[model samples]
Target: MLYSAKDYQRVRKEKEELDLGRSQFRRDFARLLHSPAFRRLQGKTQLFPGHESDFFRNRLTHSLEVAQIAKGLAQQINKRTPAFKRRSIDLDLVEFAGLAHDLGHPPFGHNGEHALDDCMKKYGGFEGNAQTLRILSRVEKKIQAAIGPSDDICGITPEGIDRRLGLNLTYRSLAAVLKYDNPIPLRRKKDTPLEKGYYESERELVEKIKAHVGVPTASTKFKTVECQIMDIADDIAYSTYDLEDAMKGGFSHPMQLLAKVGDESLLTKLHEKVAKEVPKVTPDEVFAALTDLFMLNGADTPALEQYTTSKMLASDAKMRSEFTSELIGRFMRGVSVTHGTGADIKFSKVEVAREIRIKIESLKHLNFLLMIMSPRLKVVEYRGYEVVKTIFETLDSEEGHLLLPDDLQVMFGRLTDTDSKKRLICDFVAGMTDRYAVEFYSRLRESGASIFKPI
Candidate 1:
């Protein structure tokens, strides 16, 4: 919140060419919102396809919601805090970061991310967050470069530094967009094991952001409070929106979802897994725990009081752990209490709103386990990987090589090493969408669908 549109330094050399009405940061961030990559988010999955149900939120809608929430948070903090006001924290930067945060998510949501990460393990790996950064700064150029720029696009000249590549964002704007503070290579793999942040390929850009913005990376991890706000906003949207999608798709009704948490079979599984000392007496407490978790609301004082009271019962470590798992189960059922704003998608409230965010994120690990990594999802992932693999192999063949870009053709023609070629092949396939991958694979294999226009 320290910097503003006025304070942001321009990345472009032509200060005289700069538009007086819009600041350099604002202009760059605005371009991202209007980008084809940003628009492609509409076709990408959130929890499920937006076409699957009208009630569900797609990636585009979700990003718009996050942007609104982030801007609201910025305005509120700036108004309340004298330091924020003095520092001139631009709402546009926060809004832009929120909007562009998830632009690089592949098809099939996090399942696609897992598949890509596994596929690209030797090639510096893959991460959704890192992919998003890559898209804004690089990958989008694959398409944009093929087509010449129009008046709608700003500072995009093919010749000058490949300005078409990155969002050409100011250092501060890009920094605001980075939710995770730690760079990939500097991290100890065993110290904290999570692959949900920026990638090693992005180190140079990271350094540029740090140096230009005058921010320090202390404690080996550093995130601005603004980034924290955007991260929490993303969390709130993800938890609630996924639940909404499930409900609309008839995956789980709220009543049945609540009932299933303490179901007899689930209780048996929990007891067996947790190995509670007082097995006989703990089941009822567990039932109460499950109920308190699913039914608890944090939007009102009574709900907060109930949540607090329920937590008081978790005095012992075993009870706490048991309760935590039960809460997770409820979340995985994809059921959530509605606040009746008709999916209004604003996160502007102060006191109780923060608590809602806390409750949602508390179950993130559970959500990850149940829905994200479940056998059903993995089956789909396997299918997606097969599609990518087949496509990559076909494209590398003599017949398929004809479809490639000129640079790719020349590089592939000259490259003799299998490893380097395979990496390039992965890059090509990684850039394809679910439909594109499937279509290309089908055509190459002479399979079910027709690749050419049918009469």
Candidate 2:
């Protein structure tokens, strides 16, 4: 509602208008849904490794869930809040943000991301959020034309001008996906892990986006209310759905977890993990919360024993589905918006209730402890790290550099500096899906396949 019709306009106008009876936000959603980047998410890892099971959720499905939750949140806000009821939140824009949020994630999820970051340490660092911005603004293909003389032709130039317009997304839609405002530092910091932010190379474009979206120059946290909604929806989907995946895979059982509710060591670990984001959370609070949620009826026995002995709650699909659905509904109802004026704006800050936040955080911690950090997953993650590292090294070497695709070869040749070339290499490897990365690695190391084998 803070935006005007002009703010939803694309960077490059279409030659002939085709009124599909869709709003600008809906069109933005369509553009992303049809993109190759979004499609590649089907092959990218979500919680478990992609190759591990056909039933596990991939990045594509995860994004779809996020979009649904985001739209639901937007609708809830519009129905409940007075200010939103007057101005109305755009459901399409919120959905667009959620769908586009993870478009830039590399193969193998966080493990692959860490590998790419390590490879790019000497160059500008790699962050999935930063890559998402880059993909939207510059990397993904878009319409183009020669704006200048033919003599200046270079990489990605059909004529004399290189028109890498990406999706040419509208300002408000772009703002909704600009999850972090800070720029990654040129030099690596020894004391901390690589921070997630926009790339320094995209700084001017980011500023342009902010200006168009009417964000104040001096605001410390530049997130828009729609972006905040998308962020919370992402958290909700991750906390609830990943747990469902683990349960289906039999990696975690609710009754078993309930039995461990009083285990001091497990509770301590959960507390430590949760406290990283919510500093004041305690072990007892997390345990009590999970116990309350998972325990069925007023059965007198310990939850663990009851779950083990009782056939109804343990294996019932309906029960599990109902529990997840109820949690999502509860969290959705917890969302609230605050309106500000003047330099401050209406619907400026969106928040979930403190108790709901803690519950979601606890769910996330349980997922992390029970599934993501398990020893079996660690082995797969390490192999993923090696695969990404080896592939980058092979392509970066002088002999192997010759084997790059023609387009990348041209881009690499045009960039003279070491860091620039390295960054391009990072881009190439980071765009790969999990299966592609593994296949490429196998071709380089084990298969000894034909030279004509396409990349």
Candidate 3:
């Protein structure tokens, strides 16, 4: 509410200025919306690969859905809570956060992400959230300065030879997507999974963002008010829409999920995952929540029980649609907002009701166990992992720089440092679409090596 002009300050001065009478955040949204990185999301997978069916959610569609949900949440808070009427959340900022949140995700979804992280473990760990920051702050290619000559991105002083300011987005807009505050370590702790933090390359830029937003540099969590809404909106979309996609894919429906196909171990695994998301959640509670959620016959519990043997009735399309819509509406109502104590209203904390939280966690983990962790999808994911790494390795070979495009080749030629050069390779591989990655891998490794057409 107490924002200053610094909140709208760009990391670097614009190379070209055009004032068409748009708000600063509006221009931020336009820059992201029109970028090639955002357009590539149409080719990227969300939960199921786009090849699975035309109806499945992709990254672009998912991000759009998140934006809509986030705007709804912000509007709800602004109108419903009296505290917000005085200092309301900016709808544009929250919507921009929602739309731009997942732009850094690599091809083939998390499968490709894990593969790239494994490839770059020695240089810098790869993460979706972290990549989002990198794409906005450094990678998307909006502004480039005279190399090593003068001012830095934050108008400080240039350090790296590649003096590019991605979209030159505002500090507040950047902070809205700054989900994790920690910097990803070069080498992850032994026996731990990939870390979820920004790269060391963007540390100074992050410091500038936090300082401008009034967040302490020493704070562990740097999530902003807009970020909180976007995070919850992301969860809500993942929980409901993925379930909707699952039903359409015929992977799981009410009857199938309810029965668990009589697999005791599968049921136990689902409960374990649910417990991780919602601590101390019992198996009974998980099933109870699912039962309540998937009861398809509106709130008519007896009717659903009466037709336990009828799979057609359970899988009705109209009923499933109504169920997901109801679930989403209820969860949206669960979000609550509060300001921090003291003279500074610096941060706003958001809390969702435990009931909705349980349902969301339950449904999300259901998809995780039955779909993501399933053997059917695992085979394809394993192949994706191989494709990603093999591509990175081939491109990082002695003469690999020759394979890069003209623009990239120019940058590659400028840098003498090996780490910086290898990072350029990582960035190239990390930006491929699923089909593009496969095609490129086939040309490089398989029988179809091509020199006739441009890659």
State, as a TM-score between 0 and 1, how close model 1 is to the true structure.
0.68
The true-versus-predicted C-alpha distance at residue 385 of model 2, in Å, is 0.8
TM-score of each: 0.68, 0.91, 0.91
Report the C-alpha lDDT of model 1 over 262-342, residue by residue, as the tens digit. Answer: 467765544443333223435455445435455544325474565454444333345434544454344323322111121
Give candidate 2 misplaced runs (Cα > 4 Å).
Answer: 9-18, 145-163, 189-192, 216-219, 298-305, 309-314, 448-452
lDDT score, candidate 1: 0.56
Error of 2 at 76 (Å): 0.6
Per-residue lDDT for 69-182 in model 3, tens only? 999999988888776777778888999999999888888889889888887787877899999988888788777655555433321123336677888898989999999888
Best by lDDT: 3
The 10-residue segment of model 2 with minimum total lDDT is 153-162
Q: Order of candidates by TM-score, top first?
A: 2, 3, 1
Error of 3 at 398 (Å): 1.7
Tens digits of per-residue lDDT for model 2, 121-188: 66778899899887877677654434544564343443323456678788788888888889888668
Q: How accurate is candidate 2 locally (lDDT)?
A: 0.79
The models' CA-based lDDT, in order, is 0.56, 0.79, 0.81
Candidate 3, poorest ten consecutive residues by summed lDDT: 151-160
